[model samples]
Target: IVHGAKRVPQDAVSDQCPEPDGFFADAEQCDKYYQCSDGHITEKLCPDGMVFNDYSTEYEKCDLPFNIDCSARSKLQSPQPSEHCPRKHGYFAHETHNVCDKFYFCVDGKYNMITCPDGLVYNENAGICSWPDEAKRNGCSSEEVFQFQCPKVDEAVAATHPRYADPEDCQYFYVCINGDTPRRNGCKLGQVFDDQSKKCDWARNVPECADWYKGRLTDVQLAELENPPTPRPRATKVSKRKHQRPRAGDDILV
Candidate 1:
């Protein structure tokens, strides 16, 4: 819907007006189409980053390439490149291979850089943020990002999705999916990962992690966080309206 008339590339396709009033797609180009009205023909181009959806001749619709199949008419207009945008529109990966979490979303040859959530990488193929293992981008695998490997276990234990303590940080842990792929996770503030119990618990209860917050928090601060004050209950308001009895001749309200 965001179209720039000045940016649309000019292309001529010598075609007859098939219908009196309708839109028709060009045979060779996915972004080129024709508008016919009263036996008159006009060549049209979709926005730079989109393709003409030729599912029907009744309506003119332009959509993103991800949502439309353009195999037969895969040819696209020449890109109007800009800073960080190879094309006028679409999701693009970071120029640096090692920088996996950031990407660029381009519109009208303008760029908006975006960063994936913690422990996630931008999936160029799917155009969204996803787990490093799932994204499968070279140099950005789960092993490379997390630097943790799932311990070898029997099939039975592997199926249970076991948790393991992070060797470097007591407040963080890793969950092995199918006992192979390691996913980084963290315990909430004031808590530490308990390897024996395989869950987050008070720092004081976990022997190895008892002094995990030694320099970070004081004794009183840890106690206050571990034992937070309970929330007060709200007072209920009683209705003051009295119910009235209907008389014999009164119309009943169903």
Candidate 2:
């Protein structure tokens, strides 16, 4: 029974003081618990991925036993001592999280994995992620799988020659004036970038060939195109043949 600001016992109305700070299990709910503080009781539930830590100083809170040290507590529901996580080879922590912009190497069971959200790779020396060009200036290798795919172009070239024809679209080309975002531009009608000549020409005159060629190929050049070499089969051991002397009669007949 409760009176104005104090809780009174059922048998005696005189017992009106509030309870001390402590954890108390709820009577009706198994997953819920009560925290008594300053004569007032408040109900709370542990957060997801964690369980109530009755032995903690703040007994109402929840935590992973292995992650917290509860040795000072006299009564612990389940105490778990911290142990070393085994060394993982080649496997990085961020890779498990499906993040490609940053990488991590485990050391002594713990690693701090950081990410470069600006389409850059993490530089170990600089302790931050930076543009590949800037990373190179700082003497750091800019080799990482970026979260986004951006064409690799030299800064000087990107600034001067920002427009280039896309091989797939003879009538359209891409412009990278900002060195980041690309814009598409269409060529004039009746003409397209000649992949063979590397210049605008009649699409009908351009021979059907790979776009990588810089200029039109002659008949001899077309015939000289090399094919990819086929993979060779693995060699197998051959039994040695026994040597025998040639027959004298057989040699004379030969």
Candidate 3:
């Protein structure tokens, strides 16, 4: 909630209370604001990684940079950094060059490490997990991480987003966007990706992937997952509706 404060004397009042019992923002700093009560102005600052929301004088609010525009008042408070937290709040990428999936989420100088979903990497620019191709990190590109290249295909097939089976892992496959950009994907447990049909099916249905889960899962385990017994439905009770008398404030429906 970023707004331009009128250069008018009423809104731009700084260093002194413009009116009694109200809040005011500092003209030059996004994080600095003032609280005025009984004609006394007291300086205040928003927490690190947040900007002052100066949309209202009756209430004071601080919000994240994503929700506030600070082009006019870009100045912020001094950073209160801590271990793994650069400014007391925000998402940060892992320090390791090759560790693309892990990152840190910091709040108030404390850190919580997070891992991206499979086949995705942490995108520092957007502060969220995204595709490796989109993350654009030098050592974290899809090819560098997956070690697989998209096979050359005609424009017709490329435009359809072709799916290819992983050569090393029968349960996994690669989705080639425009026949160039590759993204890794996988079949569900107890199933394998079928290149011919471009879908997941029971391992026994795909000869090439019949032994895909051989060492990882026993035959009995795979059988149970493929053909698990269904559970009985639970009994439910339906309550009967009762007539109610009209109340003074209740609206009667015809």
Candidate 4:
């Protein structure tokens, strides 16, 4: 337990007697630590994500762990290790307790996963794990079954694609390899967009419309008919102001 005068780094109890209980600066800032009478401070650096819990008698650095095994626990009722947890959802309990030095946990699960996030691997030095984007999860892959193959696509195609394939064909339909829905769509100023698929019921969007015109059809064309705009109601006076002349009864004989 930490108490009285602070302990010195390297665990040399302060011969000077009692030290402060909480955060105190050090002659050497290699790392500021809570000193115990024992004076032993940790050599490993506390990582960015970690936090130190200061007890009246001691200070301890804690972090989550990696490399979890879900079945490691002996039974459901056994006391859990601080390293591992048994959350109810979102994650599985590695054990009643945790074993790793630094790892993430969730209220739902003892461990977010036995491993870690899908992309990031772990780095012992940095005390974190990361992965290369465009690794397995990134770049083009054959896993997806598009209606048509992208010969060589650019931004417009990316934005428009089979639904929008550049200015020339963004509104037109094409066939994707998967044969789900035809990769065809178009936007019009009004409803009943086109006779292409009898899909011309109405335009769902107006990318080039004015503020007032937006969400409204420009004209009353058959395929694009919209309800006429209603004017705002004007205010009406409930009563006229008092007459400037004296009251009729008072002025009768004046």
Candidate 5:
């Protein structure tokens, strides 16, 4: 019984703080820090060769040694350095653990991370992403990655037959309809689209044609088939008169 008065347990200190726009110390862990922005918080760990310094000012927040090569560490790596990430409308190497298959699109220095969809890769030579097979066939290096979706066809071409070979898939094609999103279709086996004939035909017959074939007729061909030319009327046969004694008599009278 050795106490002047029983000490009351102080209420647990609140760890809450105002919203932050930059780096700050972790509320529970001294070795960690929180990256705050837009009323959100993200836990982060220092990159390799860096350490968390709590005394850093706002301008020099997340203070780490100046000698550390922070840029080498990808954005996916913990405690992303502010300097290396791409700004708005700019492109940068994606943070991928295995294949470099993704890229970040900084919208106004924030927002989305754009990537090539399935069956595609980014092409650096074209300065945009594209299908890997296309890029390779087009002589683009394997190292470069780029791709994009089908764009609107030209007005002149749109009014005509809208068939176009797909650069991504040889077996697939795009059929533009009234300048809207092109309809995608596949070619039949053992046939291909014949540009000269403007129809799908046997691959053996049209070696220069694309790999896939739809076997569908164009609008003009269909119209011609529907309205065929009418046959001309046959000439009437005339009877010839007998030229025996009548001929001799007619000559004498004349």
Candidate 6:
């Protein structure tokens, strides 16, 4: 102002600077402007999902406390947690749940459970396969029905009963019993449970392995085997019968 003729006088006043708004524009730019020694930088801010904190400032980089909830997430997302057979493959290993707290078992060989009608049972308490008594009262089985899966195992077992292909092992059973409970008894593959004794008794007239099939052998199969047909060897000592008859004949004079 002293050197130039048009300049203002030495006593002129200057405009004041504006106060800062709360925003930092960018934490990177702020950090370049201000820094203090003491391991603390005066300016910087972390973005959302994060906290602008002292630990970040000390470390000279933002440290994100991970928002992860390790406990809330489970490793067992595959089968979902279950009460019975907790292991999960592509197929469920056990019944999930159904009537009451009891597990609703899937019918065998399918590796899944029968989805019972919601309010009722999951399996037949009658112990028959899909032979529902109430369903029978409605005449479910009385109608003309073919023998279910009869030929498959019987044909397969003819080769070698147990050694090659047994009917029971082929993921199915052969029950000769049909329709309602019989007055005599009924036969199931590899079993015959007596309702009277509540035991696995035998079916009458059915030929089974190891014995004659006079039918269900409800008593007990004798474990002691009969001896082989070979005859006993010669007698070892004098016979009492040999001594008896000779007394009257040889001692007749006396």
Candidate with the greatest lDDT versus the true structure = 1
Q: Which tens-of-lDDT digit does each residue in 1-254 have in candidate 3?
A: 22322233434444477788787778999888877767656677787877788788998887766566688888887788888777777787788888999998888889999999888999876778999999999799999889999999999999999999999888899999999999999998999999999999999999988988899999999999999978989889787888789989999889
* Backbone clashes in model 5: 10
| Candidate with the larger lDDT of 1 and 6 | 1
**Model 1 C-alpha lDDT per residue in residues 1-254, reported as the tens digit of each score:** 52432322223323376777798888989988888767667778887888888889998889777777788898989888899988888888999997999999998899999999888999976789999988999999989989899999999999998999999999999999999999888989999999999999999999999999998999999998988778999889999999989888999967
Best by TM-score, which number?
1
Over 4 Å off in model 1, which ranges? Answer: 2-28, 36-41, 53-61, 233-254
lDDT of 5 by residue, 114-226 (tens): 66654455553343565554334333223233222445678887677366665665445655555443444566655456555656655556665533334555544444544
**Could you tell me the lDDT of residue 4 within candidate 3?**
28
lDDT tens digits by residue: candidate 6, 1-254:
00101322223311111112221122322111223333222333332112222333233332222322223321211222333423221222124222221232322222344443322222222322343323242222312121232233454443432221123222122233332221122234434443333334334422343233335342343221122246779889866664445554575657
Q: After superposing candidate 2 on the true structure, give the runs of residues whose Cα lies further than 4 Å from its correct spot.
A: 1-150, 195-199, 209-254
lDDT of 2 by residue, 21-40 (tens): 67654444323455666655
Which residue pairs does candidate 5 place in steric collision?
Answer: 122-145, 122-146, 123-145, 123-146, 128-146, 129-146, 129-147, 130-146, 130-147, 187-213
lDDT of 3 at 36: 78
By the TM-score metric, which is better: model 3 or model 5? 3
Q: Where does model 6 exceed 4 Å of error?
A: 1-121, 124-148, 152-166, 169-173, 176-208, 211-254
Write candidate 4's Cα lDDT for 137-159 as tens digits: 22212222122444445555445
- When 2 and 5 are scored with lDDT, the better candidate is 5
Global Cα lDDT for candidate 3: 0.84
lDDT for model 1: 0.86
Q: Rate the local accuracy (lDDT) of all candidates.
A: 0.86, 0.45, 0.84, 0.33, 0.46, 0.28
